[model samples]
Target chain A: MIQKILNEFSVNFHFYMKLLAEHIGIIAVSISIAVVVGLWIGILISKKPKLANYIISVVNIVYTIPSIALLGFLISLTGIGNTTAIIALTIYGLLPIVRSTYVGITTIDPSIIEASQAMGSKELQILYKIKLPLAFPVIFSSIRNMVIMTVALAGIASFVGAGGLGVAIYRGITTNNEMLILVGSIIIALLALVLDGILGIFEKLVLSHKLKKIGYKRFTAVIVAVIVGLTTILVTQKSSKDTIEIASKPTSESYILAEIAGELIMNETDLDVNITHGIGGGTANIHPAIEKGEFDIYPEYTGTSWQIVLKKDENYTNDKFETLNKAYEESYGLTWRGLLGFNNTYSLGIRKELADQYNIETFSDLAQFANQFTFGAEYDFFEREDGYKALMDAYKLNFKKVRDMDNGLKYQALFDGKLDVMTVFTTDGQLSDSRIKILRDDKEFYPKYIAGFVIRKDIIKKYPELEEVFKKLENSISEMDMAEMNYRVEIGKESPRDVAISFLKDKGLWRDKDE
Target chain B: MNKIIEYDSITKSYNGKVILEDFSLDIMEGDFLCIVGTSGSGKTTLMKMINGLIVPEKGNIFIGGRNIKDENLISLRRKIGYAIQGNSLFPHMTVFENISYVPKLEGKKEEELSEIVNETMKLVGLPDDIKEKYPSQLSGGQQQRVGIARAYANNPKILLMDEPFGAVDSITRFHLQEDLRSIHEKTKCTIIFITHDIYEAFKMGIHILVMNNGKIEQYGRKEEVFKYPKTDFVKNLIAMAKLS
Candidate 1:
């Protein structure tokens, strides 16, 4: 199984390299901006030594915020992807860079400062020639530390659609594929090590006055120049094609359905489609991007609009689609396209061992013994409405503890017996993993959540012909068809694009021009 | 001789503590004036006032017949060289860079800067090749000569030294004093030095200002101040120095 997963990476080496560059680029950009801004702030604060402590206190508080919680808070202003990720990571990188800068400058010998002043050095001159040059080693070491930290955190940023190796790792875990996670993690760890090593050499050069006289700093400059040159070439080359952005929440079914739609669109049209998958905060992230026109399309569920968007918790059997479509039009200025004929609602599941031991097959039956088992769930399953809070209240049950596992790791955690129960999507491919058993929702706490395309309203208006072409996808996929597609990509370790293309070919919706 | 520095009734205080009150003095063009004072007697403040490193609360300091408050402070400092305590050299710079720093700010050409650096190093009795060494690589005596060379590079009208030999060993400080005496004779620049040691003061100064509680007890040529003790503070300080 691991070999099959490794084969997937080798087959798509070019595409994965682009993704890796995108990840590291986000981290590099964030660290660069943080160093510049943090230094500026540190200098300003250090000037009024009285204010330095207070400013550092504030930065300390900001640094203490959990990364996931911080990302959730920043999602609204910056939205998903690189903007939000860079902003959050930059905030996280600030403390060390700023502290180093402040301490480095402040600790300079007063006699040195006096000598510089007595030599007729202006304030700016003293800073550039004496203070900053003296502070270079300290400042550079702190920046190296910030870079290593930002690289690790960049993975978490992938959850918000920032796109990194973390995305691949999450996809791996959600699919319960061990090898893919191993491949992604090892690469990320190694990237941090290599970068720190290079910067370490640079720091030593700064401290050695004799080596510096002969232009030893040029060694560090050369490395920077090469990385920047390659990143610029690759990034420019990657974005050279006019691409349409499609986004999806972190789930197998969402990825498969979105991939199918993307494939169908790309096959019929000349447009290059860029799919940003496994987005955190679900529609909370996607709707704003769609409104701002960052994403052209993504597959979204209807019940999310009714319950989460419209804030109506009660499940209405009929008119769910109408109310959701109207809310999208009025509230978000987006359009909900024809359904794919699936309602992938949240459902409870247990390990097969527990299920067989108690003969538990329904939600009501589990409620009696809920306290005997620990619950695990994805972030949104515990955060959003129609999620853990509402579900538990509706069922009038409580588990021993509800762990907020990442959506990708929930299934794996359950199978490993780390959790007795976990929340799963109705069409989750991992449902066939043998170790997991589904529990029927006897109380029906969740609303009808029919899945379909959510497109920017302006998109259809601009490309009117494309709207009709898109309508062809209406009811083209059933729940079982989607589950099968997800199973192929998630469990079979096939690429989402391959699964999507084969599905389109089987349905006679697409044909290669050469074929 | 024309006066190169004059302090006019300077009053300075910090945090409600009076450091100097109505302090005034005139320094001749080429007098080697060493100030001896108890701790916190404001001798350092008086030296700093000549270059506007410390601005007085209620009076003006005139350097080369110009009021320091009216003159641009940086320009005033460029004409008055300063070295203080253990960190006389900029640690990150080479001895050459440290010596040439003031001249570079004056926008001297590269050749001119190097010429001035070499000449000043020689004047301070530092080895020619030591110009390329960082302060950290140099011995304490070598760093002190580099600091003196840096001061001489500007060809300033006055030199201010505050405890410049305090961190060096006695052997090095004695050598540095000999170097200073020779450099002083060659340049003929007015020097104002502060030292806690009575021996250092007597050896370095042509004229001495004996101070206690921010007040000058005696200001005259070393022999005259030694021959006539004006106050009990000066008599006791000199007797104590002789015994030590």
Candidate 2:
């Protein structure tokens, strides 16, 4: 297992380095801003103690908010990407810094203050010359905590389509690839520990009497260097404007489709392509991001675009593709292209043994034995308009128990026999397991989720050749092809880009000869 | 000797209770005056008024023949050295930095500040090598000397000490007292020392002011006050000193 992980690390070394740099950039910028703002507020409250409790209470309340929920809330206002991630991380980084500074300043020996005052030291002089130096050890420890916490929390940045090691972890979980998850987690922990050790050395240098003067100069130099490095990273990132940004939902299939689209665009067009994998809420986040031009294209499902994005009340089938495309182009300036020749629609899945024992091959057949078996699905399945409730009402089926499990854990639940039946997408990589039987939607109760690319109108206008590249992908991938590709990445531990390129090459869609 | 500090009819109260009522006193130039009092007798408060650290509701304090209300308080404090109990030395600063703090605030040049620190340290019987050490690295007696050096560094004309040696052992206290006496003789600065120990007052003071309940029980030369006690409080304090 260790050797496999080491191999994975070596294979994806450049990918990890890029994400690591982005992670450092996010932490550097956010922590620098937090320190300045937190110190100012801390000093302000220390001077006016009447305001201390109220300000600290406000910071404490913000700190109590779960980071993921905070990131989700920030997405509406800031849009998605590093801006939203930085803002959320900065808010999380504030409480410790503010509280520590306030406590450190206020708790200094009163006699020391009195002595300075009596020696003709002015208020500002005493604060700078005496109080801050005395309070530094306390404040530095909290900053150390903030830095370590920020390093770990930065993993969540990938959720909102921001770049970080979290992309690896999120992808790992979505694909049920344990190696990627373990590697991402271990790297994040190591990053935190390394930063903490560095800070410990810095603290010692700054606090030691003989080394104080030189240590301060070195500390300032380190801070300046970090700021410069982060600025360069941010500037260089923004300089690449002739680039296409493709996004994917947190699923192996979405990643594969995005990689395919990215490979095609890069090969055929005179433009660079950046793909952000495993966006947190799928279409819910990616739709707004595309409209804001933060992302240029993403793989979205027809039923999801119609119901979730367009807020249509009815189930969308193959016949409504034109209306869905028209609504997207007219209202959101987004156009759907490249029907990937698959219906990854919702289906009931059961263990093959259970299916045979019950003689159930369709929704209607399962309805008879529903009361005897436990049903499980991802959390959103119960909440979506065309989800669990609609399906149950359509078939008049009521199970003995229903479990709301994570999308990643549902397959394991079914395999363990803890779940007798569960919701599954037709092209889900886990569905390729022979032990699980995909039940027929004989009643056609679920909406048709034909997979395709949704691109911004402006991107299509800029790179007209992209439309031709996407057209070749139209009706090209069969359901088996997509499931097989997903299985390769999810179970076979193949890179999505490699899987995507191979799939496109096999179909003669890859323009490697022209490139 | 000229009167360097005079308080006229000072009235001060806290929480509707009078701490000092109609307090009046004169501190002469170059006098090593010790004020011996029990707690709440307002000895520290009275001494603080000279440097404008305390304000009396119904009194005028004249320092160096000028009404302190007319003087900038920072400038006034710069002219009057003040030290308190427990020798509140700033723990983060080196001994040299602590000693030269006031002079630095006065905008002395780096060389001048160092010279002043060296001179003050020598005056306080501190060795030259301890200058770079922080307060936390020093012994209790050493910290107290640094505090005294800091108070005297700028060479103020008046020094107010409120039990500056209160936290040190008796041996250290005796040595500190003798050193302070010599420092006073060398500088000839007016020093107002407050102490709960009457013997400390008798041994070190040129003049003694016995205070009880914020009123002056007796005020005169130490020998005169000891020989001719006019109040019961004065007699009791003198008797305590004799017993000790």
Candidate 3:
């Protein structure tokens, strides 16, 4: 799997290089802006000592907000891409820089100030000539802290079409391709290290004014120039203005479904269609964009929209599709383009070897020996209302221990025998390759989370034939087809677009217009 | 000689507590005047008020026969040289830069400022090589010399020194006191020197002004202050200096 990932990297080396550059470029621009402006604010507040606490308190509040949520909020104003990313990252970057500047200037010896005043120095002259130079080291150190944070946070910028190495990481996560995740993570880490190392040199030079080393900043600048140059190439490579923008949550099934829709539309019509997934905050992030017409469509689960969006409880119902249809149309002007005939509901799974040992085919059967089993699940599953607690309470099963692992790592832990049972989505690509046996929900513990398209209602109306052509996807794909498609992309080393196109082609929904 | 510095009914407070309340005084030209007071006695406030570093809330100050309030503060400050204790020199600037700063701010040419820096440094007995060194590299005595040189850079007519030797060792303090007295005699400039030490007051000042709790305890020639203490604060302060 690692070799396959590396092969993919080599094939897309230029693209990856450009993406990493854009990532660093975004960081460099945002951080520089933050330092300059944040310092001014710091100096301004320092003059008014009484206002310092209030200003910093407000900035501290901004820092406390989640970066992704902040980005989503900023989208309304900045309207997307590098501008929005830079703005959000700058806000996060300001807190430390401002605080440090304030502290650095305030802490200078009063005698020095008096001496300057005695020398007939103007207030502005005193600040620039004396205080700032003395305060550089403290301020730079704080800026270093902010740089590291901003680099990491810039990964979320990919959601609003801000291209960066985050694209690879997001792709890796959504497809369950661990090697891609590792590759993207390593590059981002290296970029941060290089930038920080350069900053350290600048800090040192500021303090001692010594020629300890030659060409340190120049060398760093060259590397940055190269990254920026390559990034420019990759950014400019974006073509196809005539495109329907489809968005998806960061999930394997969602990505595949969106790709399938895009493939079908591009193949059947003269119009172009493309998917931009890995959106932050999953449904919460994508839903607003779709409402604002920034995105045209995405695949959502019925259970999620019902529980999260409509605020429903755990009562299972067959009339869910009708209620969701009415609410979405009236409230959001969105259309539920019917189910894809697959129910990717939540399930509990154990290694087949362990299941055989315990003779557990159903959740009720596992309940007797539940005390002997150790469970692992994702962080979201632990918090969602219809998640772990509900399932455990409804099933009346108490496991020996429950560990909250990452979504990707959960299956790996179970496979390694670290976990006796783990959470699984029925349509997960990994389930096809693993010897994991999903326990049947004999007690009907989970509500149906049927997968289908949630498109802007206007798009369906504007392209009336879209409603008919899309409804053809209703009851079309089965559970096996979804699992197979996910597996092809996840383990078979095929791209989601390819897997989707192949599936759509086989279903006769994708064909060249000439053909 | 003219009253180069005249403080007229100056009242100032911080957080509703007055530091110098309704105070008035006159400092004559060419007099090495020492204003002696303990901490928070508003001695520093009197010196700072001359340079307009701290402003009086109620009344006006006249420096060199001109009302300080009527003139541009920047030009006023340029003509009024001020110095303080240990950290008076800027740590980031070299001795030369620190000394030349006042001259530069007065719009003197760089070549002229260099001459001023060297002449002032020589006047303060600082070595030529120390001009290139930062204040941090200087010894306590050297840093104090740089501070004095910087104050005299623009050749101000009235110079203020607030406990200038307070932060140095006894030996360094004695050396600095001698250097200051000689510089005062040579320059013939009015000096408002503040100190809590009675010994420094008597040894340095030609005239002594003693203050306590924001009011003048005694103002007279050093000989008169020594022979007759006008207030209990002055008597106790003099007695304490004698004991020390």
Candidate 4:
């Protein structure tokens, strides 16, 4: 089972590593931030009895909130994916750090404090030179505990589409792939254990000034530097490709570019567009990448470009596409090419047989049967401005139940007939392949998402021909073509680039002679 | 010599019980005043008030003519060296370090402190070989000597000792009392000594205040307090010393 899991991870090593980096990064950042903040707060509170009591009570209360629920609550505000997870884990790791700091600082001998005071040391000087040094052992150990909790909670965060070993583990569990599950579990456990051991040595160093005499600290530093250097070299060496990297979220347009547009751009333009997939909270993960010139191009939706990207919320009809295009052009220092052939709205998806049998052709018709169906959805779909919850409230549909499923599993569950219905991305290629029929929102419950490749504002100035490349892709791949392309890559187990190339050739956008 | 300390109408209580009421005293600059009181008679509490370690409920303690308050506490405490039984010589610090602690606090450099520590330890008859040893490894008598060494390190104007010889053997206690007399002659530090043993008090104390309950039953020169025995409390205390 372990071998099989290892093999599975080895096969999708890129996906797992990216996920590991993000989850572990958030946890690392959060814990460090928490330690610095918590230690100071703990020390401050130790000095002030009344303030300490109230801060401790607040931390205790926050700690009592379940990790998963807190992540969900955070996701409601920050949207789905790793950023939300980082936020939740940061908050959860505070209590141990705060409490330990408080206990440690307060427990120092009163005589020591008196002696310091008698020596003409001010409160601040005594705290740093004496109190903190005395409290170092306790504080660092609490941070060790926080690190462990951080790794564990970082895994939980991955359930909200926050990539980490958690995503791999959850994916393996849902698919009943024991090998994948073990791969994620073992790696995560190993990471935590190794980090814990490192912190153990750190705690010893802090407590025992004698360790400085032994040269053990210098030895540890050398070992850490070597390990980090070797890991970075190993990861970079493994991803050998004639690669053109494009950073993107795994949304509808993202899949289209990865499964369709990437190959087209590469084929006609003589570039190898390596689609480095990521999860998105709209332009948060992509726009900055474009501005920093980290990515060459990505398929960003028009509605997001309008409301989420351009920072405008004025309501308009489908004709607002021109307004969005003009706004992107005027404000964002980027070109907005014309749309992809379809409108990817928030589709109410159900099992095809159920939809056909019940004659539920539209969201209004489906509302009458809502009490009998449980809807599964991504965390953001329940909270986004144009999310399913807002749509549900607008249409007054009282569903029997609502379940939040991770992005990777929501569609799989729907296909398995485990979920009665789901709020799905309109451009998601899964809707076509899984044979799940989507109920039309006859009341126009969501805005139109016209897919287009968004590049850095300066890319146009760098390469004027990029505009021609986007125009060639405009209205070329329809909804059905995008779905077939996703099936070929995701389900057929073909490389996403291969799938994209084959589709482009079949569409005659690129000929065999072009390569 | 001027008076180094004065306790005026100093009253004390613990948990609604009066332990010391209207207690008063004056210690001339170099006087070694031993306050002899039985256990629970508020001798320790009175000594603590004199050092500003404890505050009196209804009266003031003037140390170098300044009332014990936040404004004068640090300087007042630095000038008064205090030691309790078990020697409370910081367990983690070596004897040398313990002796040099107060001098260092008074901003004395290492050269000056080292000289003072060695001289103080020698004056108390602590051997040079045990200078680096911690208090825990030392004998009961040695610990008490180190305690005295530390008290005199800073050249304080006054020293308060609470039952300093109580923890040592009788022979050691007698020798320590004699050492205290010679050390006091050399340093001229005003010592307010608290002891339950009336005989030791009479021998060590030039002036004795025989205390019972919360008030002084007799106060006069050591010979006079012992000879007069005015109140029944003082007489009983005198009788108890003879029986012990």
Candidate 5:
């Protein structure tokens, strides 16, 4: 285990360091915002006892809320992204800061107050000089605890689409990769340890001094350092455009496809790939990641790349491959590496008996009794215009209820009759194995298309060889062949690289062991 | 010739128990007036009322003919030197800072303030070098003297003390009383002191108020209160205290 950990450290040392630096920068900004806002509130509370009571009560209530629920609540409002993550973490970090500030300032001995007042000092002067100074130890400890919590909460922020070490852990969980999860968790723990060590040194220096000499100079210095340090971290952080990251959606099928394509290109070509999974399927996040230079390449579905990204209705199909090919290139400044010969089309799927019993031969057939049936769909499909939701509106079908299910669980829901019909990808290997029947779109409202590799327009110009590799894969595999490749990786527990090589050898695209 | 302090018809209560009803007193300038009473006799409450720390629920307190009310309460508090049984020094501040506190609060120049602090420290018999230390480092008696120096620093016209010498050793208490007398003579401040020790009151007070329940049974010169014995409560207190 140690050797494995050491090997990971040696290989991805820079990656983890960069990830650490990013987490620190983000967390520092979050904690600073929390502290400033909390302390201001704390000071206000100190002045108005009743306001303090209300704010403290609210913060205490917020602290009791489950972290994931809070993240989910924010995601609904802000959309899944880093802003929601930071805001949620910052809110969680507020309770200790505000409570400590209140406790510390209010608990100073009343006699000291009498002394200050008898000295002709004003109320404000006494608070700043006597009350706050005496309360320093307690307040500082609360801030220290807050810093630790900010680090932990910031890691969880990655769940709501914030990128940090937590991304590695979440991806690790979905893919069942223990090593990746361990590394991510260790980095977070170390970040907390390092922060505590720094603060511990600070606490020692502060408390070691003659408590009397802890006047405005020392107090102001600490505040100044915190402000300057936070600003420096934020100002000097790497922008999205400066580095390359590659993320894929759906932990199983699409991710494997993107990984194989990325590995082939990154090995045969010169670009790098980060290969993250589960960021809402298709070209939406990938397109932006590439445009922002966070990712260099990802596999995107044709209908999604066309209908949604290109903003064209299904009518403009001069050719399924040719129209999408031409449109994406011009519109997104991306090159559609010719089709990989797999159409992961959105099909109206149901259990074989349900499909036969209802005599649902076409999507229009379902519209007659659509209000009586419940549909189960992957969360994103409920919203996307090119997704099952849009097709329902295009064909004027209304379902009794549309429940969101995880990608892996939707098929199970169909088999169990929990869903009357679900939107499933046509090319999912489980469709044939699970005995699910697909209904035809007689109105041609649904688009038939292949999923394939997409790279930035600049990457194609930079590495001309990428076009040849994508072309080779396109010619080498058909829809059934691609489905079989996905089945081996997804269910057969075979690595994508092994699956790719086996497929390449069977098709005579790759040389055998002798070569 | 000396009339720096007086409390007229002072009445206070807590939880419906009359503690100091219809209490009246007077202290001349430079007079060390100690009102001796047992615990809960309202002596501490009366002194606090005189300094506007606690207000009488009934009756008015005139400090320099300005009735002690909201308008001049804080200003009156600043001018009345105050100390309590708790050697309640600001823990974060040094001995010197706690001593010079009042002078600084009055916006005295730092250089002159330091000099005045040094002079007061010497008068209170606190070592000049102890100014650099914090209250936590000092002994109980030393903390109280720093309290005294802080109270005396403002040079207020009236000093209100509630069992100020109660926390120290008898030797330290005697020394503190002597220091108090010398400081009062030099500053000409009227002192309204509270104590349970009748002997200490007789030893130090120009006038003594023997209080029982809520009202004063006798208020007269120390010699008169000692010799005349106006009330049974006063006689019993003197006999119980073994006051000669």
Candidate 6:
């Protein structure tokens, strides 16, 4: 496992560097803002003891919110990507800083304050010279904790379409690649340790009498300059015009689709292309991001777009594609293009041994034995409008137990005997395993989830040639072709980009400019 | 001598418990006036009022014939030095920084502040080598001397000491008292020193004011107060001092 991870690391060194830089950028900006705002609040409450309890309690409450939930909530207001990520991280960073600053100042020897004040020092002077310097050790320790916490929490930022090392972990999970997950985790841990060591040095320097001669204000100015410089460089590095931004859900299938689209666009045109992989909530998040112009295009499904994005209650069929496209264009200024010709519709899978013993070949056949089985599905499937409740009511099936698990882990759970029946996408590569049998959806209750590209209308207008490139992919992939691609990536341990390129090359879709 | 500080009919209380009521006093310039009292007798409160650290519920305090209520307290405090008991030296600051703190605030040039710090340290018998040592690095006696040096560094006309040497050993306290006396004689700054030790007051003060229950029991020259006590509390305090 370690060798595989090391091999993966060497191969993707540049990719890891970009992720590391984004992670650091997020942490640096979040912490800098937290320090300024938290110190002000700490000083304010320290001066007014009556407000200290109330303000600290409020910050404490905010701190108690789970990081993922907070990010999800902020997505509505701040949209997705780094803005929402940074805002959530900054909120998390505040409690430690504010509490420490307040505690540090308030816990100072009262006699020292009396001495400084008796010397005719103004309130501000007493705070800057006497109180802050004395409280330096305490405040610095809390900042260290906050920095480390931010480093770990920033991993979740990738879930909302922000760039970070979390892309590796999420991609690894979705593709069932443990090596990628391990590599991403190790890098995050090392980054935290490195930052902590840097802060330790700073703490030592600031507290030492040698650095005292330099003046605290000047020292603070240098730190602020460094943070501002980093943010500027990172922010300006993202070029806005004439560049295509592509997003992918946290699935190997979505990742492969995105890479194919990106490769084709960059090959066919002079446009710069950047793909953000493994967005956390998949279509639920990527749709909003595309609407807000944070992303220009992403691979989405017809069933998901219709039921979840459009909030349609009616059953969706292949004939409804035009209506879905029209609704998307009218409501969200998004256009669906390039129906990938594969329907990765939701289906049920049972352990092969259990299926053979019960002779459950279809949904109606499985309904009789549903009471004896423990069914498992991804968390989103439980909440979607056309998801768990609707499917259960359609089949009139009631399982003895229903377990919510990650989409990536449901197949593993089924094989492990933890789940007798699990929800599976029709084209999931894991279904190729002999231990699991794909049950037929005889009732045809699930909508056809034809994979396609959802592109912003403005982007299509800007790059008219992109439409032609997308048109080449329409009705190009079959169910067997998609499953083969997924199996090569997941079971064969092949890179998604490699699988996509190879598949496109075999299909005669690869544009050879040199030829 | 001109009256340096005059408190007229001052009243202060906490939780309806009277600390000082209808209190009046006059401190002459260049006099080392030691106000001796037990805890709660309001000696610290009275001295703090001269620096405007404490405000009386009623009455006015005049410093150099100017009403302190009308004075900018920051400037007023700059003109009056203060030191207190129990490790009051700023632990984060070096001895020189602690001593020069007031001078720096007074907008003295860096060189002048250093000179003032040096002179004050020398006056308090601190060696020049320990100038950069933090208060926590120093011994208890050394910390006390640094505190006193900081109070005297500003060259103020009035210096307030609230048992500044109370935390030190007897030998160190005796040395601190002697050094302060010589400092007082040389600077001729009016000093209002509060101590619970009557013997300390009598030994260091030229004018001794004995307080009992927030009121002055006796106010006179040290020799006169020792020779003749006007109240039973003053007589008993002197008797205790003599016995100790």
Highest DockQ among the candidates is held by which one? Answer: 6
Question: How well is each residue in B111-146 modelled by candidate 1, as lDDT tens digits?
Answer: 999899878988888888877778888998998888
Q: Model 6, A1-515: lDDT tens per residue?
A: 67877889999999899889888888899999999899989988988888999999999999888888998899889887888889998999999999999999999999889878888989999998889988889998999999999999988888887878887887888888878789999999999999999999888887777677787789979988888887986797676678899999888899899988998888788898988898777888888888989999999999889989988888788899999999999999999999999999889999999989988899999999999999999998999987999989999999999999987678888888999998988898877778988888888898889999999999999889999999988998887678778998898988899998888899788878885
lDDT of 3 by residue, B1-244 (tens): 7887888899998789998877888889899999888788888878888877788889889877789778888877887788886677777777887888877877889789888988998999999998789888989999888888888888889888888888889999999999899999999989888888899999999999998888889999999999898988889988987887
Which CAPRI quality tier does the interface of model 6 achieve? high
Model 3, C-alpha of A94: deviation from truth (Å)? 3.1
Q: Per-residue lDDT for A130-211 in model 1, tens only?
A: 8898888888888988999998998888777777788878777655556667777767888899989977776775676545
How many residue pairs clash per model? 1, 0, 0, 2, 1, 0
What's the TM-score of each model vs. the native?
Answer: 0.87, 0.92, 0.76, 0.66, 0.70, 0.92
Which RMSD values do the candidates have, in order?
A: 5.3, 3.4, 6.8, 8.1, 8.8, 3.8
In candidate 4, list every pair of residues with a backbone clash. A5-A179, A244-A274
Residue A62 Cα positional deviation in candidate 3, in Å, after optimal superposition? 5.1
A239-326: candidate 3 lDDT, tens digit per residue: 5566778888877778888888887777666667856767767787677778888788899988888877788766545576888889
B1-244: candidate 2 lDDT, tens digit per residue: 8999999999998889999999899889999999999999989889878877678999899987899899888887887898899958888889988888888899999999999998898899999999999888899899889988988999999998999989999999999999999999999999999999999999999999988888989999999998999998888888888999
Q: Where does candidate 6 stray beyond 4 Å? A: A213-218, A348-423, A432-443, A513-515
Which regions in candidate 3 have their CA more than 4 angstroms from the true location? A1-8, A29-33, A48-50, A55-88, A156-163, A210-241, A263-274, A300-426, A430-478, A501-515, B10-23, B37-41, B107-109, B169-182, B196-203, B212-244
TM-score of chain B of each: 0.97, 0.98, 0.96, 0.94, 0.92, 0.98
Q: What digit string (tens of lDDT, one per residue) describes model 2 on residues A435-455?
A: 899899987898888999999
lDDT of each model, Cα atoms only?
0.83, 0.89, 0.83, 0.73, 0.74, 0.89
Q: What fraction of the correct interface contacts does each predicted structure contain? A: 0.85, 0.76, 0.91, 0.03, 0.56, 0.94
Order of candidates by DockQ, top first?
Answer: 6, 1, 2, 3, 5, 4
What DockQ does every candidate get?
Answer: 0.71, 0.70, 0.59, 0.13, 0.38, 0.81
Candidate 1 residue runs with Cα over 4 Å from true position: A1-9, A214-242, A318-320, A346-426, A430-446, B240-244
**Poorest 10 consecutive residues by lDDT, candidate 1 chain A:** A233-242
List where candidate 2 sits over 4 angstroms from the true fold: A213-215, A348-423, A433-442, A513-515
**Clashing pairs for predicted structure model 2, backbone only:** none
lDDT of residue B153 for candidate 4: 75
Using DockQ as the yardstick, the better of models 4 and 6 is: 6
